[model samples]
Target: MMRLVASDIDGTILGHDGRISARTVRAFQACADAGVEVVFVTGRPPRWLYPLREQLGHSGTVICSNGAVLWDLAEDRLLSARAIGLEAVLEARRLIKQLCPDALFAAETVAGFHLEPGFIENPTSELLAEFTPAPLHETLTAEDAVVKFLAVTHSGTPDAFLAQVQPVVAHLVETTHSAPRTALLEMSAPGVNKAVTLAAYAASLGIEAADVVAFGDMPNDIEMLRWAGHGYAMASGHPEALTAAGYQAPHFDDDGVAQVIEARLAEEKLGA
Candidate 1:
């Protein structure tokens, strides 16, 4: 029986209007009512998770920044943070500049976002409402630790960008795309991903990989999906996620996650 539900936020659960539907909300409530731990695992930063916290009634752990931080949403406190070392951050910035000169960059510092003018926010992001813009040079030289770095392109696809930078920096840092269509590429420290943090959280709760069910629609979710025993890729999911998941669910706008969650709840009720 599944004991945990790890879900990606932007595409896996939220509706097109960037809010939770009643159906999805009910699914989460059912999970809680059934004593199953619910985790929002995503590439979204902590600031962006506030609305979600309110939607879920602020009662669970959120693995944010693609696994760089674990937040106790109910208490509205940060439990732990894993930042990329200064040396690695500098090295990755240097390599990206040399290979992709025109790429715009942003870093998620412990406090908040330090972004350049060229960087664009996802239409669904709430963090930008209070973010501060800094020069790329100034941002990269900050004394604060960086949780994640984003490379955004004014032109070109994320796949092309990923291919161009993988060989040069993959060994030095971890890289993946959160948004499938945009040229937004996300980077975390070596060996960091949703899977790493989620697995650790599960172990702490005495839940194994076989007892977790995860959902996603982007490349960043690929690792987490693969790590879960029953990974469901959205019908409109990215190619990488589709390849990584063991099964397929309906589309996000169609309440695909709710469909799956409600089904699981029913099975539990029936002892199936």
Candidate 2:
């Protein structure tokens, strides 16, 4: 039996309007009523998760920054945070500057976002928390270790930018993105992807991968979908996610996540 549901935030649950639908909320509430845990696994930062906690009725865990941080939503406290050391940050910054000179950068710490003024926000993207803007040098050397680093370029396609940056920094960090079309690149600590983190958390609860179902719609979600026992990609998801997942759901705007969850709940009810 599927005991857990791990889902991505932006493209999987949040609609193009940038809000979670009532149908999605009801589906999750149903999961909770059934004693099935629903966890959010996403590339979003901790600061972006509080609103979701309210939507999900303040239940479950949230793996944010592509798995670099885990928040126990029920308790309203942090569970764990994985950070990239300054050395790695310095190395990554060096490579990013070398490969994409015009790239803008930001870092998501456990506290909040620290960004340079150059990093533009997608109009459709979630409104960011108050940010600390610093010079490139200070931004790279910020006191606290960062959970994830972000890079944006106006020059080329995201895939092309990633192709140029990956080989240089792969050894130092894990690389992926929730928005590939925007030429955004997200770097997390080495070995910290949604799959590894979610699997670890599930194992802690005596649940195995086979007992979990995950959903996603971006390249950042690739490892997560691959790691779950049953993974569903949104029909309107990125092409790479479609290739990575075994099943597909409807679009986020159409309440795809709720549809799938309701179906699974029906099956469980019949089985019972």
Candidate 3:
């Protein structure tokens, strides 16, 4: 029987309008009542998780920064982080710059969001206020841990950007992009994708891959989807994710995750 539900947030459970549907909420509640764990695995940084915490109305463990950090929602603290070193960060930046001169850079540290002045294109007044503007090197201190490294360009789609940069930085760091349209890439320490961290967490709980169900809608979710025994790619997911997952569910907006969970719960009840 499945004992855990691991899901990506942005395009899997949270709608584009920034709302979690009532049906999704009910399905999660049912999981909680049935003693199954629900973990949100996403490329979002910890600071971006507050709104989701409010919407969910409960706290638990969240795998954040595409599994670079493990967060405790109840305490609003980081349990652990597999951060990128300063040398790696700087080296990756240097290598990418050689290829794309105009590539903008940003870093999500344990402290907060730090960015190059133009990292975010057309920033709103609020965003401009939230991000600390500085050179990437100046933003981090020797003691600071870099959770995720972000880079973006105005030249091509995200896929194209990844194709160009991945080969260059493959030796330095792990790279992936969640946004299909934007020319942005998110990087973490080598071998620190969603699946690696999720597997560790599940092992700690004595749950095997065969007892876990996962969901996602992007390239970043590929590893996790492939690792889970029953991985569901959203019908409207990216082509890579659809190919990685063993099964497909309805689109996120159509309550695909809830539909799958509810069906499994019914099956469990019937079998019991």
Best by TM-score: 3
lDDT per residue as tens, model 3, 1-272: 98999989988988768888889989998999999998999999888886567888769999999999999989999899998988999999999999999999988888788789888777675667877678978868768799899999988899989999999999888999999689999999999999999999999999999999999999999999999999999998999999999999898878999999999999999999
Give the Cα-based TM-score of candidate 3 against the true structure.
0.97
Q: What TM-score goes with each of the models?
A: 0.93, 0.92, 0.97
- What candidate 1 gets wrong by more than 4 Å, as runs, is 121-129, 140-142
Pairs that collide, model 3: none
Query: How well does model 1 score by local distance difference test?
Result: 0.85
Superposition TM-score, candidate 1 onto the true structure: 0.93
lDDT of 3 at 36: 97
Root-mean-square deviation of every model: 2.3, 2.3, 1.1
Candidate 3 C-alpha error for residue 242, in Å? 0.4
Clashing pairs in 1: none
Q: Rank the candidates by TM-score, best first.
A: 3, 1, 2
**What does candidate 2's lDDT look like per residue over 1-272, in tens digits?**
87999999887887657678889889988898899987898888766776686666656688988999998777777899999887887779878988878988888777667777668655334443355467656755657769998889987887887888988999999988777468989999999999999999999999999889999999888888888888999999989999999888888778998999999999988999
Name the regions of candidate 3 deviating beyond 4 angstroms.
none
Q: For candidate 1, which ten residues in a row score worst on lDDT?
A: 120-129
Better of 1 and 2 by TM-score: 1
